[model samples]
Target: MTAITVSRAAQIRFSPGQWLTAGLIVAFLGLFLIVPTGTVIYTAFVERGTGTLTLVNFADFFRSELFVRSFWNSVYVSAMSVVWGTVFALPLAVLTTRFDFRGAMVVQTLGFIPLIMPPFVGAVAMQLLFGRNGTVNLLLNDMFGFRIPFMDGLNGVIFVQSLHYFPFILINLSASLRNIDQSMEEAAQNLGSSGFRLMRRIVLPLAMPGYLAGASLVFVKVFDDLATPLLLNVKDMLAPQAYLRITSIGIADPMGYVISVILIVVSITAMWLSAVAMRNKDYSTVQRGGGGMARRKLTTGQSIVAYGIVGLILLLVLSPHIGLFLLSIATVWSFSPLPDGFTFAHYGRVLEDSSVYIKNTLIYASLAGLIDVIIGSAIAYLVLRTKLVGRQWLDWAATAALAVPGVVLGIGYLRTFYGVTLPDGTPLATLWFMVVLALAIRRLPYALRSCYAALQQISPSLEEAAENLGATKVRTVRRIVLPLMIGGILAGFVTSFATAAVELSATLMLIQSNADAPIAYGLYVFMQSAAGRGPGAALGIIAVILVALCTFASHYVLERSRRLVEQSHGTRH
Candidate 1:
């Protein structure tokens, strides 16, 4: 029997339906992702029009002073954002995870609020509150006879990005802290280490994996960001330069392609370094009974200090949201600590004239979310439950989208698909459906991860039992596997939908008409003018509400599903 099993495993077998599903997935990814990205890379390396391979494009990139400066500027801004992010996140993560704090849950909950709004949307509000001649600076000058350059040049970019991206670190590090076995810390205390010294020597080292993961993510996201820097009018960064070059100089220019190649390299390198840093390091020491590291109780004086620290941080964290709300209602709000006047006219204006943006967002995000869950489910099943050859390659290909910047993907789509016209002779790249595809591709990795996690929690024996009872694979997946995985699939869809709704980088490159624009694009357009700031802020708030509702709905669905499953088990037992 063992010999027969081994021989059977060595051979490939699939039903017609399985073969069809696999073929369709491969074709979709190859046509939309691989071919377009390859075109961009190829354009960077080959001679224009002649198609002859050459190194001149890259040589020119390194030799140009502007491009070199832009490269270094991006590096500098990304590094500084990570540093500031650590300062903002480290204390919150430690206090909430390792100490007995009353408001820990609140801190954790509010910390994620920044992520709901895009950093660029917050960038304008940050300027109103933090910029020179803005609210804070005006107050400081009046009281202290001096002003600080919080939103001056690159400093502005770093400040806005750090505040927005720091939650990534906080969330990852908190989870890591909770997973640390208490035995290690107790062992360190046995050796007379009980304070900050113990944390530095033992706890932090164990949590290094989470720290690096979050920090590297922050770095990549900031580096790939296009709208924030452009909104701040800091155009010397790589992403903005790529957008400007491609849009202003047309697709024929090699500079944009070269910069895109460099962006891909940096993104890959950051993720690689994070992985290499954790290589061969076994920090997983959670024993069966080890819930987590024991928490320390704060003394009375310590409580006051901790609360004070949290209060100050919370104020900074909520500044953007507050400023945005005030700006939305204010008739005039320049150089004032508060809005000159408040009104609901902006919201009314948005509802009356900008309903198209909201409608389009609902349609596009829903379609993109639908596409993600389907592909994510298929890929997850193929990799986990099948013996198909090269099955793992599908997972890798889907995940590799994480390293491809949105702008790079947008550029790739433009170059690869612009020539293919519709029946009306319209360029395929200019169509609105291309926007949905770009969003789906950009967000696929996230959904795939969710599906992979969902499938991992199921026991293989259940599927084997169904098959032994003569159930077909299709029927089993539909009736058994998918129903069980619905919670994760819904979670993935919400994540993809929320993020895709606010995504502006790729859509900025692809949107060819106002009628096809989503909320993010409309927000960007409104934000560019002083007269439109109120309406733009109103739109931003609406986007936030939409995402918040979706998040709540997902949680409600998951809870309801859990109760239903428990009731079914009770009846069966």
Candidate 2:
């Protein structure tokens, strides 16, 4: 019997418990993500009222001059954002990883600061700082007698988005650079390859996979982004058009559904392009005696230049945080370099009246995070541990959510579930739980990756040992697998919570009232009005604080746990 059990486990045969877990996950994903998205796609290709299959909706989309222009504009903005993001990221990544730059850790840490604040929240603050009559231009006008159009029209959207998202590139590129075997660089150096020529030829191509990964992410993110372009008032973009069509025109409008289809297609196409670029190219270099690339010391001039560049990027990244803080307290900050006076009235008002946003965000994000980890863990376990038929399909399904835009998902939910009335006669889509579901589906891929990492680190032998001792599979998982994954589960939960707290695109559509709004939705509503900017800035600050605290706390706890484990091992030795 023991031999049979071990053999079955080795063969990856599905047990009753595994089957049950997978069934639950499949039902959840089908009910929430697949169904809604499918509804949007089906509606896009079908004739309205009659539900007859037709291509007229897509043809209408192509015929619309506004939509055609919006499509191109979205493409241009997304591509340019990737280009600018690469520019901001490349130097920092190279300087830290290639050379022994001082404060490399600090540079990397600070590089990630912009990610905590949603790009849309920074749009208003950026306008204040980089607008025509704003501080930077004003200073430039005074000093150089010329003002650069840093925040004009589409330029403003690209600038803020690039500054906010470049960290994605920085992180991936730096890791890639670090992983390049030192021997490869040494061999190139022996052939008299040095300096920029060597780096361009040898180093970059090796790290292209990582670069493409990050660039693809930046492209898709910028492409699907609704709030940033909306906050910037650049509505001649696909995402904003989709959003406006649904909310302004109505959810039944095929234009909105058509636009959502285009968004998903574009996202998939970009990812496919990235994959195609890296396909058939072997980048593996690490071998025996080859750990990572060797770091070289920078010269005095090089150090100064590197530091200056890093400092400038850091300042630009931190500008939103600084400007948000200033805007929140400023009595009146208009047509000037500084505020007329300072007051905490904005914060007070937010805390007093708009505290519901914060409360809702906490509830929604917490619930979303909970859902993600539970589902993510199950998928990860099924994929890694079981050789059950189609186990990998579950992972692929969950990860597919990454390509679906938030606005598209929102439209999907409205179209698919709004007609499904509850026992209370309320539209199913209007319920706050639907908002949580949208958030979870949107962030599920990230949480799934985290769970995969956690589960991968655990040994199958541990479970096998438990099972050999007559413990049931469920009991072993409950006693050993879950406890071991606590750290990763917590980490995944915090990540989902932090990101979901500021996710507005879907929430914006789902929010039936201000009472059900999350921080991101409330921030958007607040940023829309001139009078509401101050309160919006205050709310933005609170969101930044909330995400920062959660991220920092998770990092601190994980690090502390690692230290404790190391200490225990050291004492044992």
- Give one digit per residue, the lDDT tens place, for model 2 in 517-570: 889989999999999999999999999999999999989887877687678769
Best by lDDT: 1
- TM-score of predicted structure 2: 0.97
Error of 2 at 203 (Å): 0.6
lDDT of 1 by residue, 1-573 (tens): 999998896667766776787889999899889998999999999887888999999999999999999999999999999999999999999999899999899999899899989899999999999999899999999999999999998999999999999999999998888888999999999999978899999999988888999999999999999999999999999999999999999999999999999999999999999999899988878595347889899999999999999889888988999889989999999878888899999999999999999999999999999999999999999899888878899999999999999999999999999999989999999999999999999999989999999999888898889999999877888889999999999999999999999999999999999999999999999999999999999999999999989988998998999899899989999
Evaluate all candidate structures by whole-model CA lDDT and list the values in order: 0.93, 0.92
Worst 10 residues of 1 by lDDT: 9-18
